[model samples]
Each structure stands twice: as C-alpha cells, then as structure tokens.
Target: MVTVTAAVTEASSELIARARAGDDEAFQALTEPYRRELHVYCYRMLGSVQDAEDALQETMLAAWQGLAAFEQRASLRTWLYRIATNRCLNTRRTAARRPATQWSVPGVEPPEPTRLGEVAWLEPYPDSLLDEAADAPPGPEARYEQSESVSLAFVTALQLLPPRQVAVLVLRDVLGFPAREVAAMLDATVESVNSALKRARAALRRRPPRAQHEPAPPAGSAAEDAIVAKFVNAYESADLDALVALLTDDVFISMPPMPFEYEGLSAARDFCALFLGTGREYVLVPTRANGQPAFGLYLRADGVCRATSLLAITLAGNRVCALSRFDGSVLPRFGLPQSLPDGP
Candidate 1:
C-alpha cells in the first residue's frame, strides 16, 4: 500500500509540474478530480447553481494562473477548496443574486403565507453531480453527516449565515478541515476561525431543529420508496387529506425565488389545497435533488404537460418534514424536459 501510494503521489507531482509548465491537458487532469466536489462546496456557500458554476470557473482560472505559486504544503484538494471558498465569498459579497419572484400563477390565488422566507435565491443541487464526488469524507472534527450537510434544509440554513461564518462552518464542521488548515485557507488566525465556528454553530442551533424528528429513511430504500409513491399518488389525485397525512405535524413548505413560505401542518395544507384545487391536471416526473426525493412538476392542459416547477422533499422517517419548490427554470440542470406528452 505504501509503495502504491508513493507512486500515485509521484504521478500527481509530475502532473502538477506539467500543469505549471503551461500544459493545458495536464492542468485539466490535475483539477478535474476536484471539480465536482469544489462545485458542491461552492453550491453550499452560494446557494445558487448558476452562481456556484461561476465561482467554480473563476476558481479554476485562478488556480491555473497561480499554479506556479502552489508550494504543495497542503494537499491539492485543500488548496482548491481554499480558492473555491474565497471565490464564493467574493460572490456572496458582490454578486447581484436573483431577486424574489412574485406569486403569479394564473387564476390561482395562494393562501396567505405563514411568512416570507429569507433565502429566496436558493436552488437545488442535482444529485447526479453528487454521485461523481461521492468519496469525499469529512475530517474528525466534522459535525454533520455528508447527506445531511447537502440537504435543502441545511443548505437553506447555511444561506442565512454571514458569508465568513458560512465559510468557517463549512470548512471546519461540514468538510471537517482542521482549524489550523481552515485558518490558513482563509488567511486568518486559528483563534478567529475557532471564534467564527462557535458563532456559526450557535446560529445554526438557534434555527429550528430537525434533530427532533426521526431520521429519514436511507436513500432509495423501500421505506423511502413507499413515501415517495404515496406522495406521487396523493398529489396527482389531488387528495389533500392523503397528502396531508404524509406530512409531519410541523411540516414546512417554501418556494424559492418566490418569497412565500408556509410552516406547520395547517399552513402546508392550505398551500397544497390552493395549488391542487386549481382545475388543471398534473403529472410528476421523479428526480433527486440535494440528497432527497424530488420531482419535476408538470401541469397538464390541452393534452400536453408543461413543466411548472421542481419539488424536493425532506423526509423524517415515513413523513415529510419539509417541501421546497424551485422554479421550473432549474429542470435542465436535472436533465428533465420542459414538457412531456400527456399520458394515457
């Protein structure tokens, strides 16, 4: 194992040397391995897929330009993360993020919302991309599981945090980077990093706790399938009672890019009734987002089903704990079509 490891390291070093010498292919080879994970990190930081993509491109460009200065004191992965994190911080600070969209469905008046959500620019991360970065393991200091860290609820909570606290928390708790390494990455002292982490943790804890609910069923397990199947059936049939029965007592609902949010079972029920009570028929194309069950929602009218939105749910045991509705504009990111032919 030692010999194999040394040989792999030697090859990586050679790739780095070639990349530094301006070999574009070598540079691509060196950075490609970290690209998906870096993108995920950026998504966690920025909350928008488009913004994450932009940050990722900028990070790669900066890395390539600064390759000569990479002294290899840290693993290349950590170095990439440092670049990605800083790039995301810059974006969070300067970018004009997407604005909140209004409730504009034709002939449908949504019930009064429970409250306006703060994270209006949030977008779902496609699970397909996550498969490519599956092997990333958090360090010993990590406080969240990999799947939990990527959930819609967790990511939404992250967006509410200040950018520096988000960075510190993600590096120290989510990705499990050591305090010294995180401080080095952020060009700060370890003491400051620790302080930021403490504040971030406290802020996160102050947010509503999902820990009180039972754990979600394992991905793709029978338990999960049963819940998803019931959701599809209830939603398609417009059976409000059946759908409501599948929700936890405190089930939360929010539509991003649109500020509407509904919390608790009653509010969720009202929102669902308003949405489903419309005379139009519907269909759901299954997909996964942010490590949770998601579907491309389509409105069937005049024998054609047109995409309307994407819905991702957070399950606590057999019942859903939260539902996130994203704009239909994100369907392409998950390889879902904009429209589908009406089913028999």
Candidate 2:
C-alpha cells in the first residue's frame, strides 16, 4: 500500500505541475482519482447520490479554477473535500430538508407503523460504486471502515446531524483525518472540530443500531446466496409462515420517503401479508444494495409483471434482521426494468 501510495503521489505531482501550467488533460488526470471517494463522501454528508454527484462536479470546477492558487499545504483529497463540504453546506441551507418517504401503494393498506423513523428521505447506496471506494484503506485517523460508514442507517443518522457536524464526523471518523487536518479543511480550529464530532457522536449513539456485528459475507458468498435464495423462495411462494420464519426476532423494516417503521417478526409478517398476500405470484430478481443482499421484486398480475418493490436485507447471525424496502422509484438506479414477462 505504501509503495502504491508513493507511485500515485509521484504521478499526481507531475499532473499537478502540468495542470498548473495550463494543461487541461493533466488537470483532469489530477482530479479523476479523487472523484469517486469524494462522491461517496458527499453522499454520506447529503444522503443523496444525485446531490453527491452534483457537489462533486462543482468541486472539480472549483478545484480547476483554484489550481493556480494551490499552495499544496493539504493533500489534494483534503482540499477537494473542503470545497465539497462547503458546497453541501450551502445546499442544505437553501434546500428543504428531505421529508420521510410516503407510502404510495394504492389499495393495499400497510399495518400502522409502530413508530416513525427519523430518516425518511434516506436512500440506498449502490454496492457497485462501493467496489472501488470502500476497498480503499481508511486513512489513519478514520475510526470506521469505509464500507461500514455507508450503511443506510449510518448515512441516515448522519443526515440528522447539523451539516457542519456531518462534515466534521465524516472527515475525522470516517475518512480518518486527524482533528487538526479536519480543522484546516473546515477552516476552524481543532477545538471546534473536536466539539462538533463529540456532539455528532452523541447524537448518533441515540439512534438505533444501523447494523449487527456479524460480518457480511462477500457479495456472492454461499451464505449470502443461501439467505437470498430462501427469501426468494418464501416470497415468491407467498407462504407467510415460511417468509416470517426467515426473519430475526428484532428485524426492522423501513421504506424510504416514508416515515413508517416496523420492527420484530410480527411487523415483518404484517408487511409480508400485505405485499405477498395478493393471489398473484411475485418474482424476485437478485441484486445488491448498500453492500447487503437486495432483490428487485415484481408481481405477476394483469398478464405482465410490474415492479412491486426493492428490498435490501441486513443480516445477523445468518438470519435476516433489518429489511429496508424501497418504492419502485429506485428501480432505475439498479438497472431493473419496470416490467417483465410473467413466465420464467
């Protein structure tokens, strides 16, 4: 890793020099490597993939315009973050806070939610994007693993923090930057940075656990395959008992853009009873989301299969624990078709 880092730095130094000398291609080269991680970081701060990409584009443009003034006091990564953080902060200041996801299904009434979830505007991050970003080693000061930080629950908890605190916590804890460096990026003193992180940590602690301790097996591991197969079998068969049997006792369910939250096996059963009880069969197209097992669910009705739902499942001790259900609005991001043939 050290050797690779040195080579990258060497390459970036050359590009930086050429870019400062007015080479557009060199400037692009200098900024490209940082884009994805920056995007993930922005996503973490803003809780929206689209928002993150927009901020990243703006950050690149800002970096380009400011390249001439680059003192190189901080690594390019840190400098880019400074710009992106400010951009997100500005965005949050003007944009209305995201509302909880609403239940939009017609005719099928879900059981009354036992409690309202705080992060209704939460969205799932694609595991494919994490392919490169999460695998990169967390910086020395980073307390949380990169992949772990992007968990829906963690990102949701992050959205609840003040934007500045969000930046501070991500920089200090997720990226592993020291307080002094985060202080520099945020244009604040170390003390202020530390203070913000402290508050953020306390607030995060008050939220429900976003994940269990069991290590998520590799994306296509046998264990993951088994659990996913079980889900598909139970769901497609519309066997409520078999379906409920697959869930852990404390299983959690949330549909983003809606505030409703259901927990435990009984609530899971209620959800299954409504979504699967339709006499028509459902089809499960295997997929991935937020580094967890996910599926694109479709229902066979009216001679065609149409999008019914998307589920991102969290695991604990080999049993499904947290099941995050998303409305069809998310299907496009996963490259899932809106409809499919009822036949295999």
Candidate 3:
C-alpha cells in the first residue's frame, strides 16, 4: 500500500492540477485549506456562528460551481475570499437577528453581568483554532495579523458596525486588503470604499475606550492560574459575593444575540444576584475561546445534567472587564465533550 504521506502529497498535487483544469473535486482540494479560516472570517462578519457556517458552505458550493468562470487574474485564495464575502453579505440581508439568551438552555445559567445592547454581538470561537491561526503560515509580508484580530473585544467591536462596514473594516484593517481590491470585491467604487472605511472607523472611535489586552497568558503564570481558579470556583459555587471580588471596579459584561450589557462592579454584581447564580447550579468545564481563557458552563436543571453555554473571558491587568457566553452549540467546535463529571 502507498504510504499515507505519499498519498496525501500525490493527492494534493493532482487536485491542484485538476482543479486548475476545471475538475470540481480538484477545486475542492485546492480550496479545503481555506475553508476553516474562511468560516472564521464569515463568523466574524455575521456575529452569528450559525450564519457563518451557512455562508461558508454556500461560498464553497459557489466556488465549485463557478470554477469555469474563474480566471487566473487573482490568486485562488483571493478568489475564494471574494466568493465568501459575497455569500456573507447576501446572507446578512435576509438573516434574522437572534435575541441574546439571558440564560443558556433550561435552568443552567451563568452570572449575567450585562445587558445585550451595551456591547456588540458577542460570540465565541474555539481558542485552540485561534491559537493555531496565530501560528499559521503567513504570506511574504504577513498582510493580516491574526494575533489580536480574533480577540473577544475585537470581534465584539466588529459586530457593532453595519454589514458592509464590517466587511470593509475587516478587509482593510484586519485582513489588510487594499482599498482597490476591497472595492472590487464589494462591487463599489474606490471612493465609496474609502468613505465606508472612514465611517466604520468613526463609529468605532466613538465607542468607549476598551481596556488593554495581554496576548496570551504565560504557561506557568501564577497570577492567571489563580484568577482562573477563583473565577471558576466562585462561578461553580454560585457565590455572587466572591465572584464580585474578582472583578475590577470598572469591569464590564455583555452578551450578544441579546441586547443586555452592564458596566461597573455594582451593575455587574446586581446582574449576578438577580439573574444568574441565584437559583442555578453550574459546573465549569475548562475550555478556550477567542485565544483567551474560557469554559463550557454546564448547568444542573432540577436533577438532570444539560449543557448551558460556552463562556469566554477577557482579562486586563489581572481582572476581567469582559465576560461573554456564546451559545451552547458552539461547544463541539472547540473539541469540548458535551457532558462533564457530576458535581459532588
């Protein structure tokens, strides 16, 4: 039998050639490398993980069907991106805005320290993938840097803009696409593109100043470990008082898909006491999201176990200013098991 390595190499080479020659399967192979990243891009655009997945699938199908019309004028990667962006834009036109969940699923709720409208649409992407993307291959000049683009704050801020603005900001600022190329992708004039970018920047600038971010926690950092432990314990125990202590005086919290957010320690504390950790019991299964610390917050409903939601936290100077809970369905994406050990 041929070795697996040899098979993969041979298959990749054959696919690339065949795809160039109009073979759909070959095109699929050539585009597979971009699928995950494109999905992430779409997700960031839509602010709904479900919408991103749908857009990605549609983009792939469109690329496959449109291969015959593709010219070599642009790199295959760029061509794929153009298809994905158009797909997301089209989806955005018809997609309904899902109200943010106050508490995930029946009875399993985490502390809701904020209202949905105060912050931008907040969702979680697998931390593992974000980390992987941080080290992924970059082109000759590394036009776009993934290091901070995938952060919770960054992604949250992105959703506050209109879809076109989202696309323009991400392409020009995050992905570093040239204005000319961005115009072509959006089918707008360069002047129009420039105006959109200006507006996007202005909108972002008008928002309150965000706290500084530390890239990734050091492996053996006692500070982070302790904070995480205390956070998890306070949350799992439903101890509102202890939980409040971990927060900074001006900490903020927001949940997207819902229009609730909270600012300041007092507001956050009220939310935890009134909505979450009041009648709910939680078990935090450690996980990662948006290249930062995170967890799968499972809840005990009556006497049965069920998944609640995924929590992604952003830390600043040893305190958490932002804590977001993405929908529970996102668990699988981060490779987290659906169930966890029952509490003692």
Candidate 4:
C-alpha cells in the first residue's frame, strides 16, 4: 500500500513537470485539479455560470500559451488563479449580465407566490455538488473559510462586492492566499489589499449573519440526518405546524437579492403556508446547499413541472434556525439536471 501510494505521488509530480515543460497532456493533467474550484471562483466573481465556464476556458488557453514564461515563483495553483481571476474581471467588464430569475428555467412557467421581491436574479445550486468535499485544505483561519462559499447566499453576496474587492477578498479570505500574493494578483500594494479587505468585511457584516454549517454530516450519529428528514417531510408536506415545531422560536429565513426576510417562527410559518402549497403541489428532489441538506423543489402546475427552488435549511444543534430559498436557474452550476426523475 505504501509503495503504491508513493508511485501515484511520483506520477502526479512527473505530470506537473511535463506540463510545465509545455507538454499538452501533462499540462492537462496538472490543470485538471484546479478546474472545478477555478470555475467556482469565476462563478462567484461574475455571478453567471456560463460566463464562468467561458472564463475557465480562457484561463486555460492563456496558461498554456504562457507556460514558457511561467517562473517557479508561485505555485502552479496560484499562477492559474491569477489568470482565472483576471479573466473573470475582464469578462465582467464586457459581458452583458441578464437579470436573475427566481424560477427554475427559461421556458418553465412559475406558480404565483406572494408578490415577487426582485428575487428573479437569485438562483439555485444543486445540493449534490455542495455535499462534495473541497479539495483545498482548511486555510490558516479555521473559521469563515470553508466549502460554504459554494452556497448561493455567499456567492450572491460576493457578487454585490466591487469587482476588485471581490477578487481580493476571495483570494485572501476564501482561498487563503496571503496578502502579498493577493496584491501581486491584483497589481496593487499590500496596503491596498488590506483596505479592500476591510471594506469587504464591513459590507459583509452588514448583511444578515449566515450560519456556518458543518461540511460533512456527523458520523453515524443520526442527529443531522433526523433533522434533515423532518425538514424534508415538513416542507414537502407544507405542514407549517410541523415545520415550526422543528425550528427555534427566533428562527430566521431570508432569500438574497430580495428584500423580504422573515424573523420568528410564526411569521415564517405564515409566509410558507401562504406562499407555498397554495395553488401548486411541491415535490422536493433532495440536494445539498450551503453545506447543509437542501432540496431541489419542483412545483407542479397544470400537471406539468413549472417552478424549482433550492432550499437550504441551517440547523442550530438539532433545531432548524434558518431556511434560505434560492432561485432555481443556477442549478446547472451545481451540476443538477434541469429535469428530475418523475415522482421519486
């Protein structure tokens, strides 16, 4: 086993060397590891999956053409990030951003939920991908830096930041790049990076405090699983009483890009009861969001799939403390298919 592990490590090292030497296949192997994360970074920066993918391809092309100029100054990972971040910012400058939609897809009809609150721009991410473990190690700062950046709220909030501030904060805070390195990436001084980070932190603090959920479910305890099961049943059933029973009295729920947010269980319950399960029946296709159990909710309208929403419930201990409903158009970012299996 030890010998086999060493061989794999040596092979990966060889691939990196060859890639650095301008071998396409070797470079492909070397770059593959960073693709998903880089794409994710672009998505956060641009707030569009299509744009992020385009930027990812552009970053690779640039990296390949400039491989000869690659000095061993920074790790290959950081170099790629520098390239990807620049691409995203450039795209942001030129790209035409479509207004966000809260419903599932372009063609799908939507059910009447209370007055829509400018949530059309908010989108859903697949729960499956959010459940996947991140490749990067937990950075030096143990808190506020985790895979949760993949969450819709975190990403949406990031989009609200200035483009440069977005890159600086993400590189320094999310990806754990040092201040000096971030400065180099942005072609700015360390002091500038510090200033940007300060403003970014201040802006973020003003937003609703999001719960930092655990990445992986607790092992074999059944605590989180039980909670998730109860949530699924309560939500799909539209049983407001059962749902409120599982929540704390002071539980809060908010959807970003929309001004409407609810505080307290009664208000939340009333909102859900009135808005959800009113005219259409809902089928929750289970997925993960915000590093917690989430559902890809499909609302049937006229016996056809109409609307989809991504729901991530934040639990405090075993009680649901917050529930965030995001629009479904962004599910592709999470690799969730547009159509779910029928009646599963």
Candidate 5:
C-alpha cells in the first residue's frame, strides 16, 4: 500500500542510509515495496510482460549502483521511477525498431480484420499482479485510479504517444506528480512538461474513451456470473446466434502482434466464422485480465482440449465492445494453465 508520497517512516530512513552504504539486504528491503508498480509502469511503456520484468531488474540494479550518488532531496519513490521510466524508454526505442510477431493459433483461421489497430503490439496487464501492489489510494490529484491506468484501452492509447509525451502524461496526470517534479524526472523545463501534458491529454481524448472506469464487477457478481454462463454456452455449443447475442454493435476484436482488427457485427461475424468452421468444440476456462472478465479458450480435438488463446472482453450493458485475444503464451502470465483436461 505504499504510495510515492508516503512520509518516509523512521525505519525506512535507516534502511535508506544502509542501502546507500552498499548494504544489499537493506537495498532490497528499501526497494521491494515499489516493485509491482514499477513493473506495471514499465509494461505500460514497453507493451510486453517479459520486457517489463527485464526493465524492472535493470532499474533496480541501476538504482542500487547509483544509490551512493542519491540526493536525499527527492522522495525515494520518485527516484526509483526516474530509473524505471528511463529504462522502459530505452528498451522501447530498441523494440520499436525490431518488432516481434503476434501469435495466432495453428488450426483456427484468424479472420481478416477490417483494419489494423493502432496499438497492435499491446498486451494485457494481469490483475493478479495489481492485487499484489494494491497501491495506497492515490491522492485527489491523481487523475486515474491505479486499476484504470492499466485498462486495456488506456494502455493501448498510451502506446500511441511519443515516448517523452508518454512519460510526461503518465507522471504528471496519471501518477499525479507535480509539473516541477515531473520536469525534473524528465530532465525538462516546467514549461516543456506542461506543453507535453497538454498535447498528450488532447491526443488521448481523440483515442478510445476510457470505458472501464470501474473495477470490473467484483469477481463473481451475479451479473458477471450470468455473462460467463452465456459466453460458455455460446462457445461450447458453437451457437453463432448465442455468441452474436453477447457482442455490441461496434464490437472491436484485435490480436496483438497480429495487428488485424475486426470491427462491427458484420466483420466480427466473419471473424467468428473460424470458430464455427473449425468444427472444434471450444472449452472456455473462466479467467480475468486487465480488470476485465476473460476466458482461456481451448479447442477440443481427439478428446483433448489444447489452449488456443486467452480472450479478454470489455462489456457494455451486457454486450461485449472489445474482445482481445492474446497468444496462448500469455496464459501462464495470468496464472491459467496452458491446457485443460478435456471433456468438462
């Protein structure tokens, strides 16, 4: 529950001193509280789970090695962010040059998308990790809730901004850092930070609306439970009508790394044609992702259900507006088994 601005407790003051003096255990204790949030920040910047982990490790090592040069002036939290955010920026610059492929299933024919999504490289942030960091309630100045900041739409919009603008916006608005302090973090003038913030805010306004402002319906609400029931029935029964009933008119479906997107019911129906044509009964293992309801889909063949994709859905009035199907490689990241026992 530690936030960036919590008054440094007396005990931590001691740890900080020892950590500065090259005490490894003291440094570990000193930085441990901020790990999860930093991990999320890096993920926001880099759009990859594995890269975020690597960034976190590099940030910590840099923080520890550079601790001796620390000026006690800045909050330890802000200093850690200085290292973490820059680490993310550096990693992203390299990744942007050499992007990886978006994974698709072997047997399932991915429908041709109407158009490509802007943040086609985007990935979901696991809520389980967010639970681990459960940040102390941010102060009023913080514009977005911790959970909202990681919403699939919000994060995807972020991937579209310039790196410096992303840094400014996340720091100044999302994290509620003051302009002066954020400028210090970005090594820019206050005026420059303010200007970037203005542009970033406008750019985001033009992107998708922040639809998921609420924490996803608490883990087993009757409403969510019913929705899950309908989804399972549709997939297992291969009832196209049942499936179509659950989607919104402007439904959006995207698979990252693949970049193809299906929009509107007509296109979506074309996309789901694969599900119907595959002739494989789907088994959906209920799960969660990015503070939204999700399912790990397994395709059944020869009495075995193998993992195919991890699908996260965004709901509107009981209909789905967005359906993000990630490569099954992300299954383990959400703590879901890659494969399930067949015949439920």
Candidate 6:
C-alpha cells in the first residue's frame, strides 16, 4: 500500500508540474476528475444551474491561470472547492438574478398565495448529473447525507442564508471541511467561521422541518414507482380528488420565478383545481430532478401539444410533501422536447 501510495503521489506531482508548465492537456487531465463534484459544490452555493455552470467555468479558468500559485499546502480537491466557492460568492454578490414573474396562466385564476417565496431564482438540478457527484461519501464530519444536501428544500434554505454563512455552513456541515480549512478558504478566522455556522444553523432550524414527514421511498424502487404512477394518473386525468388524496396534510407548492407559494392540503388542492379546470388536455413526461420525481407537462390545444411547465415533487413515503413548478424555459435542460405529436 505504501509503495502504491508513493507511486500515485509521484504521478500527481508530475501532472501538477506539467500543468504549471503551461501544458493545457496536463491541466485538463489534472482538473477533469474534480469537475463533477466541483460543479455540484457550485450548484449548492448558487441555486440556478446556469449560474453554477458559469461559476464552474470561471473557477476552471482561474485555476488554470493561477496554477503556478498552487503551493500544494492543501489537497487538489480542497483547492478546487476554494476556487469554486469564491467564484460562487462573487456571482451572488454581482450577478443580476431573475426577478419574480407574475402569474399569467390564461383562463385560470390563481388563489391568493399563502406567501411569496423569497428565492425566486431557484432552479432544479437534474438527477442524471447527480449520480457521479454524489457517489463519493461526504467526510466524517458531514452532518447531512449527500442526498439530503441536494434536495430542493436544502438548496432553497441555503439561498436564504447570507453568502458567507452559506459558505461556512456548507463547508463545515455539508462537505465536512474542517473549520480551519473553511476559514482559510473564505479568508476569515476560525472563530468567525464557527460563529457564522452557528447563526446559519439556527436560521435553518426555524424553517419548517422536512423530518416531519415519513421518509421517501428509494429512487427507482417499486414504492417510488407506485407513488409516481398514481400522481401521473391523477394529474393527467385531471382527477382533483385523486390528486389531493396523494398529498400530505402539510403539502407545499411553489412556482419559482413567480414567487407564488401555497402551503397546507387545502391551499394545494385549490391551486391544483385551478390548473385542472382550465379545460385543456395535458400530458406528462417523466424525468428526475434533485433526486426526486419530476415531469415535463405539455398542454394540448388547437390540436397541437406544446410544453407548458416542469414539475418536481418531493415524496414522503406514499404521499407528496412538496411540488415545485418552473417555467417551460427549463425543459431543454432535462432534454425534454418543446412539443409532442398530437394524439390520444
């Protein structure tokens, strides 16, 4: 084991040397392995997938340009995370985020929302990309499971935190980086990092707890399939009663970029009723987002079917606890077609 470790270290040294010597291929080779995880890290810091991608690109560029400054005091993975985190912080500070969109569904009047959501720019992360990024287990100090850390609820809560607090919380609790390392990454003292983390944790605790619901079924398991199948049947058939039956008592609904939020079974049912009463036929295409079940909704009208919205649901055992809707602009991100052939 010692001999193998030494050989691996030597090879990594050679790669780093070549990378610093301006060999683009060597840089790519050295950085490619960290790409997916770094992207996930950036996504956690910045809710929008587009923003995460931009931050990731900037991180790579900066890392490559500053390769000579890498003193190797920390592991490559840690250094990459530091760069990604800083890039995300810069984005959070300077980027013009998407504003809240008005409710504009034709022929359907939306009920009074329980409250407007604060994170209007929130976007779903496709599960297809999560497999490899989440495969590696988090470090020993990680307080959140890899799956929980990526959920919509978690990501939304993170967005509500101050950018530095978010960084401190994620680095210390989610990724399990030591406080000293996080302090170094953020250019702050360890005492400040701990203080920020404490405040972040208290704020999160004040939010509604997801633990109240029963645990969701495993992905792709028969239990999950049954719940998804029922949802599709009820939703596509426009059976409001059946759909309501599948929701938890505290079911929550939010439409991002629109700021509308509905909580409780009654409010959720009312919202669903409004959409179903639109006198339009609908179709659902299965997809996954944030490690949960999602569908691309298509509206059939005038003998033509066009994509309408993307819906992602959070399940608690057999019932759905939350529903998040995003505008049709995100369909392409899931490889969903803009339109489908008109048929039964």
Assess every candidate by TM-score.
0.97, 0.92, 0.81, 0.76, 0.91, 0.97
CA lDDT, candidate 6, residue 100: 86
lDDT of 2 by residue, 112-176 (tens): 89798877686777777877563346678788875578888788788788888998988888888
Which 10-residue window of candidate 6 scores lowest in summed lDDT?
131-140
- Range of the 10 consecutive residues with the lowest summed lDDT in candidate 2: 208-217
Clashing pairs in 4: 100-120, 100-121, 101-120, 102-120, 124-327, 127-287, 127-288
Report the Cα lDDT for residue 247, model 1: 95
- Candidate 6, which segments miss by more than 4 Å at Cα? 208-211
Off by over 4 Å in 1: 209-211
How does candidate 6 score on lDDT?
0.90
Q: What is the C-alpha RMSD of each candidate to the true structure, in Å?
A: 1.3, 2.5, 5.1, 5.1, 3.3, 1.4
The global C-alpha lDDT for each of the candidates, from Candidate 1 onward, is 0.91, 0.82, 0.73, 0.70, 0.80, 0.90
Q: Worst 10-residue stretch by lDDT in candidate 5?
A: 209-218
lDDT of 4 at 331: 58
lDDT of 6 at 176: 90
Tell me which residue pairs clash in candidate 6: none
* lDDT tens digits by residue: candidate 1, 35-81: 98898899999988898899999999999999999999999998998
> Residue-wise lDDT of candidate 5 within 1-344, one digit each (tens)?
37643555667788989988878999989888899988887887777778889999999999988988877689888899999888887876766533546545666666666887666576777878878873545545679876568878788888889988888888867778888888888788999989998999999888755344333455567877887788788878988888988887788888887878888899988888777666778888887788788888888777788888888998665667888888888889888886777753
Residue pairs in candidate 2 whose N, alpha carbon or C atoms collide under 3 angstroms: 100-257, 100-258, 101-257, 101-258, 102-257, 102-258, 141-176, 142-176
Candidate 3's residue-wise lDDT over 224-249, tens digit each? Answer: 78889999989978888888888877
Candidate 5's C-alpha runs over 4 A off are 1-8, 96-103, 108-110, 208-219
Supply the TM-score for candidate 3: 0.81
Instruction: Flag the better candidate by TM-score, 2 or 3.
Output: 2
Whichever of 5 and 6 has more lDDT, that candidate is 6
